[model samples]
Target chain A: MSNTTHPDTSRSSDESAHAEVTVPRSPELEVEQEAALRLWVILSRAHAAIASHAHADVARSGLTLAEFAILEVLYHRGPMLLGEVQRRILVSSGGITFLVDRLTAKGLVERRNCDKDRRARYAALTPPGEALVAELFPAHADAITQAMRGLAADDQQVVAEMLRSLGLHAAAKPLP
Target chain B: MSNTTHPDTSRSSDESAHAEVTVPRSPELEVEQEAALRLWVILSRAHAAIASHAHADVARSGLTLAEFAILEVLYHRGPMLLGEVQRRILVSSGGITFLVDRLTAKGLVERRNCDKDRRARYAALTPPGEALVAELFPAHADAITQAMRGLAADDQQVVAEMLRSLGLHAAAKPLP
Candidate 1:
């Protein structure tokens, strides 16, 4: 692929500060880079191990991972605007729309007009969706608990808090 | 979508202990399950956020994430068996074979027979692959370091070690 062009290079100040990224850097910076990569690799492996079990458990319910994720959000948190669901699930608007539509076709989810806004819509799990999640969630939770049995409960707590902080900060900004 | 059967139920002792997973349980068990779920959600979010930035950086080089991952493995660690590469990258044997073939076609990688085993083959980077990775790796590293700027360097170190332990333990056993 001819990827010599960098769209960001023509962009404004936010990216230009990182113009030095393409070139060589100081030893300290290299160390930081290597450390970050190592951390990411470890994080990826841990997540992969845990997610495999979680996904398999969800798959037993005949639901895709994203589908189960949407259901779980509604089952626990109650009905919410489609936008809110999208945000919570970290999916694009179109992606959420497509999934909700599919779940709706499966008679698992429904969309309702929002009272607060004429243009907004809410996604709620139908009785079938609720029942399915209710049936499947416990097993899913157990699978996660078992997958995460790698760390002690106390250590899981610590890592949970750390990941919370890291995720919040990560969402707040990127590569700056 | 018709996922009514439980294949594991008809199987051995390894899965029977978890038969109770489908039924309701004590509050303590529920709490543990909830804690694990929370940890997993937080981990997913953190990884997604960081990976978004890293993926975008890699995309600028016109290489799919898997392809770049393979090249990086060979670039940093030198030649290795295909099976080892698959394990390190967490891809299936077929998936690694496809990526290696693609990289080889691109003139970035090659395979040679391993002397130790008649059936084993080693994947190594060609000069072009080495030059490409050497050019892109620093930027990729910088991008990672930047994406991970959410945590202090010291905390990154701590999380790295924690994830290392967690990953090792998680890989040791699927579930108990």
Candidate 2:
């Protein structure tokens, strides 16, 4: 993804033809802007690299990334409302429905009606689903560990804190 | 999107039925695994939060994310070989062709034959494209800075370093 946080101020070969319109920024803001842009690029590249490898691992196990995510959530959280599952995994409602249908057809997941709310439905793993996730979870964890093996413990800790801050900040509503 | 690095070692509410098969990992390895898993989740969430906002900003400017990316690359890199553009932006060759064609249709980007390689093509911005990016880029940069405004300067610097390390490490070939 193009991290649009910094204007490309570096001298381009076509510099003569391309003119700048914005007034000059203070040197401090310029440095900060450049840093923001660089950080965005690194963050994006790392996420893509790690995600591609992890997705490939899940794909090799005969499950799509979505399926693996749903199963993993069910495995860890026990039974959950379809809506809750959708929110937690960040899948769309339509996507969750489609995946749940496939999982249901595969006999790995079953739906249960909510006692109090007619419109609410819960999804629980079937015996096969439970067994599959139980079998698969370790290897999945190993893949993650292997993907991140390059970073040492201290670096991982620092990354976790930084990312938590960034994620929460970005996820919040933009300042008015 | 599922950061599958950590096994849910937490006692499940339905623990009796769900039993583990994998051998217990060492305490140190388990801690490391959890940290890796946590980092992956944070990284993904942060990227999603930031990218969604950035994409939306671009969308509001009457361009798709891919279109904006192509324009940004051309603006920064001057004329680039079609293949190089595809590689740099992580777009597939077919997708790049389609985007370049659309850009050409829109009169924002133009194609040129490679002087050295007859079969090769290049994509460069037209005067309008140049003017549009120059007009659009500062707001885009502001959006990025705003998206990441939660972190202080020191925190941003630390994040940049940590993310650089993580991105470089994750992007390298997996350890044997």
Task: Indicate which candidate wins on lDDT.
Answer: 2
Ten contiguous residues with the weakest lDDT in model 1 chain A = A1-10
Per candidate, the number of residue pairs that clash is 0, 0
- Candidate 1 Cα errors over 4 Å, as ranges: A1-27, B1-27
lDDT per residue, candidate 2, B41-102, as tens digits? 77777777777667767878888767887788788778989987776666667888988999
Q: Candidate 2, after superposition: displacement of residue B124 in Å?
A: 0.9
Candidate 2, A109-148: lDDT as tens digits: 9999999899999999999999898887777877777888
Q: Check candidate 2 and list the clashing pairs.
A: none
Candidate maximizing DockQ:
2
Angstrom error at residue B95, model 1: 1.3
RMSD of each: 10.0, 4.3
In the range A1-176, model 1's lDDT, one tens digit per residue, is 00111111111334322234445568787667666777788777777676667667787768877888888777766787988777777777788899899999999999999887989999998998888877886667777788777777777788878777777776777443
Supply DockQ values for each candidate: 0.22, 0.42
